[model samples]
Target: MKNKFVQILVTGILVASLPACKQRPDNDAARAKGTGAPTIASTLHFADEHTTATYETAINKFFKNGLFRSGFNGSYLVAKEGKIIAEGYNGFLDPVTKTDSIGEHDAFHLASVSKTFTGMAVLKLWEEGKIGLDDDLSKYFDKFPYPGTTVKMLLSHRSGLPNYTNYLEHYNWDKKKLVTNLDVLTSLYTMHPPLQFPTGKRFSYCNTNYALLALLIEKVSGKAYHVYLEETFFKPLGMTDTYVFSLDKAETAMPSFEWNNRRYGLEFMDLVYGDKNIYSTVRDMLKWDEGLRNGNLFRQSTLDSAFQGYSYEKAGARNYGLGWRLTEVENGKKIVYHNGWWHGNNTVFIRLLEEKATIIVLGNKYNRGIYRSKQLCDIFGDYRQSNKTFQELENESSNGLAAGGSQ
Candidate 1:
C-alpha cells in the first residue's frame, strides 16, 4: 500500500508539472507584454523504487520521531528534482475544537515567507519597465521621509526603516484599530522615526521594507497588492489554494494555535498583507517553487537578482536576497530558502537550487521542530559541512535573533 501510494503521488506530480492546454488570458498577455522570456522546464528525475523507498523511510522516521512526536500540527511535502517523493498532513485545523483535520489543500499563514512573493512582484514590475529598482520612495509617495532609500533596498531589506511591528505598538496606536499598509506609511511620515541606520549601510531585515514594497507594487501597477499577486503569480502558477489574507476571509482561514494548543486571537497587526498574511498550502507552495525554478515567471536576470546574496558586511554564511534568505554552503553552492513565524504559524520553504530539491512544511500550531526541516538538505546534497547548519540559521530566525527572523 505504501509503495502504491508513492507511485500515485509521483505520477500526479509528473502530470501537474506538464504544460496545460489552456492558459489564462491575463497570464498570456502579461507574458507577452512583459519579459517575453521563454519558459525553461526542468528535466524530470523520478527516483527508482529502492531510492524512493529509502527517501520515504528516512522522511517518515524523521517526522514520526521528531515533528509528529513533538506535537506538530500541519502539513509537509518533500520533493526532489521537481517530483513529489513523500508528503503528509497531520493534526487538526483547529486544535482547540479537535475538528477539521489538516489536508493538502489547506492554507496556513506564511508569515515572512510572504516576503518572497512581495519581492518577486516588485521585480516583475521592474522587468516590465513599469518601475526601476533604484527609484526613490519620494517619487511614489508625497513628502516621503526617507530620501535615499530605493526600491532595490526595500526588496533586499537594506532600507533601514524602523519595523512597523515594533513602532506601531510602541507608539501606542489604538490596539483595537487594525493597521493597514498605508497606516504604516502614515505613522512613519507623521512620527518621522529615526532610521535604524543610514540607508544602504547594512542589512537589517525590516518588515517595513516589504510593506512599502507592497505599496510600491500597487502604485506602479495601478492594482492592489493582493490583486497584482493573484493575477500575476498565483492564478498563472495555478496556486489555487494561496491568497493574501483579508478580514472578509478571516472566518474561513485556518486558525493558528500556541504550543499548548491554545488558539491565538487576532490582533491589530493581523490585517497587514505585505510583511506577512499570505496563506498557502504545501502543494501550492511547490507550484510557486517550480514556477520560479522553471524561468516562466521572470527574466533569468531578474530571478538571479532576487536570489543573489546582497549582504556581506557581516562575516556569516547566511545572507538576505531580494525576497529570500540564503545560506552559502560548501562547494560554492547556496541554499535559497525562507522560514516564517507569525502568531502560532510557522512555515518552512526551502530550495536546494542545484539539486532541484524542495522542502515545505506549514504548521498552524507553533513548533520549533518546523525549522529543523532544513536539515533535510543532507538527504539531497552535500550540505552537511556548511559553516552553519540550515537548522541553526533557522533557529536564530525563529528566536528573532537574525534579521527579519521572527516575522
Candidate 2:
C-alpha cells in the first residue's frame, strides 16, 4: 500500500513538471540523445505579442499593396517558431477562366527551389556512408568524362560544368519530346565541350551539377530519382500533396503566367528532375522547412554542411552551399535560402536561422517582385540583402536560364 502511494506521488510530480520541462532550451547534447542522432539546437526566439503585431502590419502594408501593383500572383507564408504569422494569396489557378483563385491547397512548381530537396537527399545518403562527399563521378559512372570532379564540388557549384541548354542549339534533338537526365549526360560525355571554368575553380551555378547528382542518386540507390524522394522524404513526412511533376499530369497540371497574364504552356524540358520539376503547396513547404529544422531526416552535421559556404575566394557577401544559396552578414548571422524560376514561376524560400523564421513566396506568374520576399527578414533582424543575386538572376531568367539554370 505504501509503495503504491509512492508510485502515485511520483507520477503526479512527473505530470506536473511536463509543461515546464518542454519550455526549457534544447541544447545540442539533449537533442542528440533525445533523437538518437545529431539534431539542431533550437535558436527559436519567439516574437512577443507586440513584435508579432508589428511584423503582421508591416507584411500586409508592404507586400499586399506593393505586390499587387507590381503584378505579383501566388501564395506567400511568413512563419516563426513553426507558427504562421502572416499569409496571403492573390492569383488565379486557371488564368483563362479566371475563376479558380489561388488558395492554400494549390501547389506551385518549385523550379530551382527543388535543388534544396536534392541536396538534402544527397546528404542523407552521405550520412549513411553509402556515398562519400569527396567521391569522384568516375566511381559511379565509369564513362563519366570529368575525372577529378568530386561529389562535394558538384554540391557546392564548384564543378565548373557547362550548362547543357547551351548545346541544345548545336545538338540535333526532338523539341516536342522531353529530354531525360541521361540524354543530357550522353551529350556532355560525347561532345566533351569546354567547361565554363576549370574543375574546382570558382562558383558558377549550373543545372548540370544537380542533373548529374540525380543520376548519381539513381546509380547508388538502384531506384529512380523520383521514387527515392517519395519513399525517403515525402511519404514519411506526410507530404501527401507534394510530388515530382509527371508528364501524364502535364495536360491537367497548373499553368504558369506572365505579368501581362499570358499563359506559358508545358514544354519538353519539364521532364527533368534535379534542378526543377518539384510541385508543392505553401503549407507542405513549411512542413519541409520544419523537418529540416527539427532534423527529422539528416544529421545536424550533414545539414550544417549544406549551409556552409565553400567558395570564399569569390567577391561577395553571397556564397553557394551544397544546394542552397547563403549570405553571411558581418554580424555572423547567416541567411540560408534558395529561389526558383521556371516558365512563369518565380519563388523564394528564405530560412532565418537565429530568428527561427521562414519566408516562402511562390508565384506562378512572372514577376520579379517575389524576390523582395527577402525584405521580410528585416523584421527579424538586420539582414543584408543580396541585391546582385536578385538582379542578375532576374535578368538572366529573361533568357530562360534562372540562377539555378534550367539547363
Q: How does each model score on lDDT?
A: 0.77, 0.73
List candidate 1 segments past 4 Å from native: 1-51, 385-407
Q: How close is candidate 1 to the true structure, as a TM-score?
A: 0.83
TM-score per candidate, in order?
0.83, 0.81
Per-residue error at 14 for model 1, in Å? 17
Whole-structure CA lDDT of model 1 = 0.77
lDDT of 2 by residue, 33-103 (tens): 33211011112223444434345444554453456567666777778877666555554675555656565
Q: Which run of 10 residues does model 1 get worst, by summed lDDT?
A: 1-10
Model 1 Cα lDDT, one tens digit per residue, 83-154: 776555666777666545565567899999999999889888889999888888899998689899888899
